[model samples]
Every structure is written in structure tokens, then in C-alpha cells.
Target: MMSGFCRTPFKYQIMKKITLILVTLFVFGCKPTEKAVETKLNYQSQVAVKGDWQVTDVSYANSDYIKVSLFDLGNTKCFVNSTWHFISNNNKGSMKINDYSCAYESDITWYINQNNEMVIKFLNGTKSKKVTTGYVVQYVPINENKFQLIEQADVLNKTQDIVLTFERI
Candidate 1:
């Protein structure tokens, strides 16, 4: 005895509710499962690092680029490099990064050692002898296209606290 217009909207509402509920359950109830295979490099023993990644951020000297390359160093460590180059229009100057190796000059290193603990070291070129330790916080994958590396920077007088977020390229 109901009009077609009334029934159509009522059915649409019901369908929407069910769809919303299903989406919520799927998103909240199911968490990403870590791959069963153990990785040789256990940077964070508790969490598995993503096997595939893309560059999310790059800043070198006066130039910045989003293209980066992540390379596996031995023992769950990694080396990231920038692959972007361009000419600056303002000064009519050329600027770009041709390398991405992180050494004492680059204040960044992350690794999961045999001890089953994650360690991050932020270095300054001047203080090559001393490395202040920071909490080896687990990074969260923001989405399919982004990786978030969050940690407190070094405790040195010149260090700046930072929360670095990178997008997978």
C-alpha cells in the first residue's frame, strides 16, 4: 500500500545504513597482518617493515624533491637517496640532489639489531664522536601511498625536534 517514491527512499536509506556498517566493520575490525615470513633485517623486531616503498620526501641543500630511492643496507638498515633535479627559476641557478647516502654528515639512521630492539641515531657532523639516543618509535603507515616516521630528534643543543612524514612514490 506504500507509494513508489516512499518505498524507494526508504530502501535507499536502509541500503546506505548497511553499507556504512559494513565499511566500518571492514575498516576497524580487520587490521593489516604482518607477513608470516621473518625478515633478515629486523629493524623493529615487533613490526615488519614494508618490502616495497617509494620516496616520500627529500631535502638536500637548497633543492627539494619528492622522488627518493630506498635501499636496504645490511642488518635491517636502509639507505635513502633523492633522485630529483631541476633548475631554479628565481636565481636562474641549477639545484638538485645527486645522492642519498646517510652518513655522519646526514643526521639520520634507523636499524633493528640482533638484540630485538630498534635504534635510531641522529648525528651532527661536529659531534661525530657522540650520538645521543632517541626512542626507537615504530613508524605508522598512513596509507597505501604514505609512510610516517615519527620520533624525537637528538637531545643536543643544536638539534631540532621533528616528525618526518614520507609518501611512497
Candidate 2:
């Protein structure tokens, strides 16, 4: 009778098992989670908004309110082409009107209010002649390239909330 015992083979087998288990654990742990991705998306939206953006669409929160196009408001050209440049660090920004006749730029201050609302203030009389300052828009992080914002205004002495869709430029 003869018997053979090899320490190397046994050790190798045990090491292989440990490695396989560790790899399985790591793979599972590294898998992307939906919640984590959503959180990251929210953060990216916040930073991406700190740059230039243009209004693409506009609508009122309530369907009862009338919808008006840039031209419908007596604008010769598209007023939705307006641009807003939000400074990166400083709480400052600028709004540019590009509707031909209303073409003008204004120095503005912006902040993410306590309610996470985007509040814009037209400073130094930069606001449009017919507009007023303190326009607060609720910030809705839709994605990296686009976001939705809503703000209430006294359009006709009645407070109405308007939703604006913006696209990064």
C-alpha cells in the first residue's frame, strides 16, 4: 500500500475558494444602485445649472392659464431664446434678452433659497422695464442637460405659477 500527501495542492485549493468568495462579494458590492445613481444625477444637475442656459419651453402649472408664445406677447422674434448665465462661485448671474427689440443684458443675483428654490434678483435696474425682481422658481432637477422650473407671478393681479423648461448651452 502507498499513500501520497502534497501540502501545496491542499493549500492551493483553500486559497482558490477564498479568492472566489472574495471576488463574488466584491462584484455584488460594486454593482450600481439606482438610488446612488439618482443622487449623483441630482448633484450633477445642481452644478450644471451654474452655467449658461436658454429657455426652450414655457407653460403654466394650471391648464386654466393661457399659454403664450414669445411672439404672441407682441415680441417680433422668439423670446424663449433668452439666455441666463449663472456664475460658478459667486451668487451672481446675468440674464440676456435676445428678442430683437427687447435685446438687453442685466446684472442679476441668484441663490438657492432655503426651500431649494432658485431665486433671481434683477439688480442695478437691469430688469426688463415691465418685469420686477424677486422671481423665485422651484428648482426641479430633471437631468444633466435639462431641468424644469416653476415660479408664481401676478400676471393679472392673480398669482399664477408658470413652469419653464431650460436646456444647458
- The estimated TM-scores of all candidates read 0.28, 0.55
Worst 10 contiguous positions by lDDT, candidate 2: 35-44
| lDDT agreement with native, every candidate | 0.39, 0.65
Give the Å error, residue 114, model 1.
17
- Looking at model 2, residue 86 earns an lDDT score of 79
Provide C-alpha RMSD values for all models, in order.
19.1, 16.8
Cα deviation in Å at residue 113, candidate 2? Answer: 2.6
Clashes (backbone N, CA, C under 3 Å), per candidate, total 3, 0
Candidate 2 per-residue lDDT, tens place, 24-142, comes to: 99999999885211111233334668998998877754544554333223331343678888775666788777877667667787666445577666775654444453555678878
Model 1, 1-169: lDDT tens digits are 5688789999999999999999999998897885332223443322343233333442322223222222221111122332211121211111122234443123444445453333444443424237654345445556555655543333233333233445433
Error of 1 at 168 (Å): 2.7
Winner by TM-score: 2
